[model samples]
Target: MAIGVAAGVSVGTVISPYAGAALADDAAGPSYLLVGGTGSSNIGVLRESGGRLIPVGQPVPTDTGTLSITVTPNGRFAYVAHTVSGTLQGFRVGDDGTLERLEGAHLAPGRPIVGAVVSPDGKWLFATVGSVTNDVQTYAIAPSGALTHVDSVTIPGATSGLSIPVVSPDGRFLFAPSFIGATMDSYAIGFDGRLTPTGSQVPTGDRPALPSVTPNGKFLYITNEGTDDVSGYRIAPDGALNPIGRFPTKAIPHGMAITPDGRYLYLPQTGGQSVNGFEIRDDGALVPVPGAEAPSAPGHLPGRVVLSPDAQRLYVIDTLTTTGTAKVFTYRVKPNGGLEATAELPVDTGVTFSDGATGVFASLGPA
Candidate 1:
């Protein structure tokens, strides 16, 4: 399974199906960073390079309350939702990048799943029973990774919380975000991975929370966290959404990280502890990446933000740190997109940052 290899350590080998494209930084292969939240029932795993992030081997339990993590574009497998144990676990990517608990695979959608994603062709694994079941479930990803449910879709006007849907790097379209019901829901990804409501919902600006999509799937961004700003859209070849407006940010913004040729875009701002940056205008407007903002460290709060599938580096995820501990900063992705802090991985003392929680989750395993 060659996913982030480490077991006996000897990366001096060969196994390329693009070898999962080396999970992220691939200086020949070795990439990982998984963290888990609500204080950790164990998931941590680190081990990237250039931008640092070390720790790999130890924390890997999972079964208390993780809230989000879904790596499987061939990085073996990783599921892990668990909104207070509503369950989802599954893991099995141990070349050396550790993590092995996948016994019966786990599953459990009884309620409160909170977030999970995986369809760029790793079969399917969507999941987000969001706040008390606003719906969006679908499973089916067996080839040993387990998980079979396959269908649920009910997000029409869900006025409460939790959101983690985004899946359109050509996997068709999924884009969910309905947190507090500001709206932003578009689907149409079925060939078996059921979910088809390209009815497009739209509206968003007051609490929309998270949803990022670019890398050529056109544009989609949406981080409204109760209106600090960032809503822009334009993915309509059928997957609906066409707004392209509200873009202010730096008050709450939550998480987002795009760049792999889709221009820039970073935004972290858990109540503005900072980490802005943008620049993706072809029509889906959003300018302001000149120096890339970035601020957190004083009181520390930045929620989730990733990039480093060779986009250089730029990972934030500070649910708390300033001593309370749960850090994972790292930057250096400047070719004009700015941001150069570089290095800061602490995590494991009760990871805190809430509201659509997503503590951290990079990939590229196989070294």
Candidate 2:
């Protein structure tokens, strides 16, 4: 059994990549949806066409326990962090949105990875590993989409449960939240892609799950699952987070997405089984968007919420459900910051409730 998962629940089939050459081109490409889940190796590759997701080809063979996937802003590369196998895999994104495994792009950390994300400049990849070890690894991204270990840092005072890290829009700051410590830790990113402690540890609500920064890079918000509220922070000149205020939400807000313009914020409440909308005030406070409560399908627990690159569509993936099924809920962004139901795409089945699920929109267009 994978670490932290209950007995008898499958994380996926153990698979390895075949030796392959890396692609050298870095041109803009088409958008694609990459989906991975808990119990099966249904690595979906879907392209967005005419307001719907069309399957590109057969499921891509990948390592088991692959719950998180992060793509570069240029859409030239994608990275997968395998929780079960304790390895990091990189792939060169083809022009047609297919994934080609890059030779020498795999790294075995020998511990479970919580998540991985690329810096906005695509120069560095940061991954969080181990529930108890609290280690963060940094890798440099080559032009051929290969990875080389650059640095590793252990979060200070983090006893356990180091959540995923989020980089600032400017790529100068990295913020990581610790559930057990109930604190949000900030780090300074050196030009060489190394991390240095910023000495800024801001207290957050109980069990803070994810941290999100607005596109303007002026404010940061974190979804506090244990407190059933959202914490707002102002990004100081030095990348320190200054508390704005704590705003109330429905219940158990796990994941969130902010619009490109930084005018609206949407959060998925797993306990409430619905998506809530809020207007981001000029001072970094959140005010509920009137009539923006969008409910999820019965028995479905929404996990990760992501917005299309253009900010016209919103997608939420179900982390757990009782119907032996999992799905991605798509919505049209209304003018008033509300969600208009568009379509639901069923992705997999027999998925037990996991704390996090991977759902990312890969922008394939030119940088």
Candidate 3:
């Protein structure tokens, strides 16, 4: 059956495949989604009806490229990383999942910021910032969706670029991979949103970049963009990382998303224009999924791959082209871990910026 999602319309129970167990939610049809785009304009929000993304309200403007977006667990607010400008922007999520601009809700933590992620508890926001600043910034989230800067901490022994930051599903640790440093940095997130390093750094293959924690919170994975591989680690109780092993990939793997059940890991290789799948073992090792290589068109530059709330669909955000014809490619995850392309939704990004590409995620919630 084709997956149809609605946002802010009604609440229903959904048994998500990603969570292994039956995760109860009020609704199966989630309403709103937001995608950040680069160009002269700001990012836009999309209303989900019948599983498709349609523009809503007005496009909220931000400086340069809105590289990444993070929404609160309750779906009340969204925060975006304006990478080019080294800043953060906020929006109040409407009841129907619409986005309303939040004025005076910007955070300037210095230049060359990369990723922004809100804590699972929805109390804190964390982001990676300036290559020279060499720090991760944390902020306290206000009830109105505005952010109040709290603290910043540098990755241990970090001497290069920082890609993005990921908080463990347990919200106990924040993982930031230093691109050139070849080190996986860990920080213990305090109850009040402050940060403290885990004392030691976990080494990686090459440019140990993007880090994603499994939904089960048992393991951590980092993509080595410089070495064309990925590394897995065992998460210690004290938020330390112990290297499991390294796995090869198609090419230049950047972004990764795991299934809700914690059974699979999906990596989107921007340079390869293909997604590689791996079956996660019970012990935190990665095994390649047979016949799970999903490819896209040549210039798609598919970077970010995300699964819908129901885990029935995976959306690949193909960064914009020079002529403004980029698209968001949708696929249906087969029963056997393979992917079948379903739809290529057109997006108007106007122009492409080489700095970085942004992505959109379709939301599911009650109307």
> How high is the CA lDDT of each candidate model?
0.71, 0.76, 0.69
All models, RMSD in angstroms: 17.2, 5.1, 8.6
Per-residue alpha-carbon lDDT of model 1 for 35-133, expressed as tens digits? Answer: 675555555666666666666645555655666787887676777776666677777765556666665567665566778898887898888775633
Best prediction by TM-score = 2
* Top-lDDT candidate index: 2
lDDT of 2 by residue, 266-347 (tens): 9999889999899999999899988778899888888877787567888777777877546677788888898888755655
Clashes of 3: 16
lDDT (10s digit) by residue, model 3, range 219-299: 999888888999999989988999999998877887787999999888888778798889999998889888778887666
How much lDDT does candidate 2 score? 0.76
**Error of model 2, residue 253, in angstroms:** 0.9
Off by over 4 Å in 1: 1-3, 6-78, 81-100, 104-123, 126-145, 148-172, 175-187, 194-229, 234-237, 256-271, 274-298, 304-317, 327-367
Q: Model 2 clash pairs?
A: 29-364
lDDT of 3: 0.69
Which order, best to worst by TM-score? Answer: 2, 3, 1
